[model samples]
Target: MASLETRVTEFQENLARNSVNEIKEQIKEMQKMEESQNFVLKDCHEKTQNMLKRIVELEKTDFDDKFNHITRRMIGEVVREHLTPIQMNFNLENKSIKKLVEEHAYTIEQ
Candidate 1:
C-alpha cells in the first residue's frame, strides 16, 4: 500500500541524515587530537634546542681530565668530603662523572 512505502522512505532518509552528522563529529575529534600532538612535539623540540646551546657555551671552559673516574673507594660520603676542600665549582655539563673524579684525584695527589 501507499502508506507502507511512505514509511519506509522516511526511515531511510532519517538514517542518511544521522550518518552524515556522525561522520562530521568524528572528523572534528580527529583534528583536535592532531593539533594537540603538534603542540607537544613543538614544545619538546624547543626545550632540546635550548639545552644544546647551554652545552656549547660550557665546552669553552677549562676542564681537568685527570682523576675524574670513580672507583669503589669514591662511593658515598667520601666523594663529597673531598670535593668540599676545593675552591673549584663543578660544571657537570662540561665533563662526565669520570672526569670530575679525575680532577678530585689530582687534587688529592697534590
Candidate 2:
C-alpha cells in the first residue's frame, strides 16, 4: 500500500513539472514572436514614411509644372493680344509702300 502511494505521488510531481516546462516554452515562443512582429512593424513604418515623402515631392513637382504651363500660356496670350494691331498696321504700311514703288517705276519707264 505504501509503495503504491509513493508511485502515485511521483507521477503527479512529474506531470506538474512537465506542465510547467511546457508553459515556460510557450512563453518563450510568444516572446520571440513578439520580437519578430516589432521588427516587421518598424520596417513597415519606415517604408510608409518614405512613400509619403515621395508622394509629397511628386505633388509639388506636378503643381509647379502646372503653374509654369499656365504662366507661359497667359504670357503668350497677352503678347498676342498686344501685337495683333501692330502686325496689322505693319502689313498695311508694307502694302502702301509697294504700291508707291510700282507707281514710281511706271513713271520712270514712261
Global Cα RMSD, each model: 19.6, 6.3
lDDT of all predictions:
0.79, 0.97
What TM-score does candidate 2 get on C-alpha atoms? 0.53
Query: lDDT tens digits, residues 48-86, model 2?
Result: 999999999987787777989999999999999999999
Clashes of each: 7, 0
| Tens digits of per-residue lDDT for model 1, 9-101 | 989999999999999999999999999999999999999999999899778644543234434446656877878655244645346777888
Cα-lDDT of candidate 1: 0.79
